[model samples]
Target: MNMHKLVKVLAPAGIAATVVTSAHVASGDDGINTVEAAESTSSNYKYQGDTGYGDGNFLLNEALIKTLEEDGDLAFNGHTIEASEDDYETRADKKSEFVEEHDQKFTLRDGTATKVVFPIQDETLSIDDVTEAYGDDFETTESKNGKYETYVYKLGDKKDDDKKNIIAFKVEDGYVTQGTIGYSKSY
Candidate 1:
């Protein structure tokens, strides 16, 4: 090749190499590195592994709920579904009129058994007993309506769906009349 042609080729190649090297230096990828490590804080919330009812082992499907209402021995986890009620809500539309809306119904109940396996032989269980069984790794919320005071215990998050694992105890005259342990709407 002629000297002039050789000069043109070599000059551009050298310039391109310098530009690439400079770009690498400018972009901060030159092997020296700095990493800011972050430590995540632990949550105070504790989770229960057993989850009382048969929830830890099997899901409480609709059929099981029906069986609980119909038969007395079909128990899951440690509780049985005693009864269910349809929930209704009042809603207002664009008009000034209010309408009644039906929401998901309450589907299960413990009926005063502390994880009591069905064929509930003896009526000897109490809500306090259930609370004691759960220990300190739980949260409680209470509400009063008429003659009944409801106590809800939030055990932990559910494994199958986006719901809370809870056990509700309905008390009247300082005695637990009903108990329910199952998944409920999170919010």
Candidate 2:
């Protein structure tokens, strides 16, 4: 099959559609088929493989994104993504859209996730959740952006920290929306 057609067929699974197609083409049927190529690409959405959670149990990667997409009823770290039609919405930003529940949000860029927002929907997650999750190793800054009061966290509190991932929590009525986990983009 042609590269364009293959990529278009798999684009719904990833932003690296062309890359996946290229890999498939390069493999030349060496036990790698279209479905396997797509699945492998979906499982490897890269973000430096870091999740600022307990013991770093969860790494926010393509598997997480696929779970949130394929199975909408996923719960993690005291947050949940409800399975409802209204739970998903497309944003004006070309790179992103979001699937939100009453307390959690997942942001996708070109069908792969770049952010996951967790709110204080339960005792396990609160305004101090990120600090607790990342421990004293994180850096924080408070700011107000329009109607949103944000608390930003940088994973490692250092001047030359190599980690590009950051999390931000939105507060309203004195309650944290818990926080958003995302990575910086370079164009």
Identify the candidate with maximal TM-score: 2
What would the per-residue lDDT of candidate 1 be over residues 40-153, giving only the tens digit for each residue? 221111111122322121112222222232222232322232221111011111122211112112232223221221111123345455455445554444553466665654
Where in model 1 is the C-alpha error above 4 Å?
A: 1-123, 136-144, 157-163, 183-187
- What is the C-alpha lDDT profile of model 2 across 80-136, one tens digit per residue? 323222222222254656665434466655554555665343233344544454445
Residue 186 lDDT (model 2) = 13
lDDT of each: 0.31, 0.40
TM-score of 1: 0.29
> Where in model 2 is the C-alpha error above 4 Å?
1-94, 101-103, 122-133, 145-151, 156-163, 170-176, 184-187
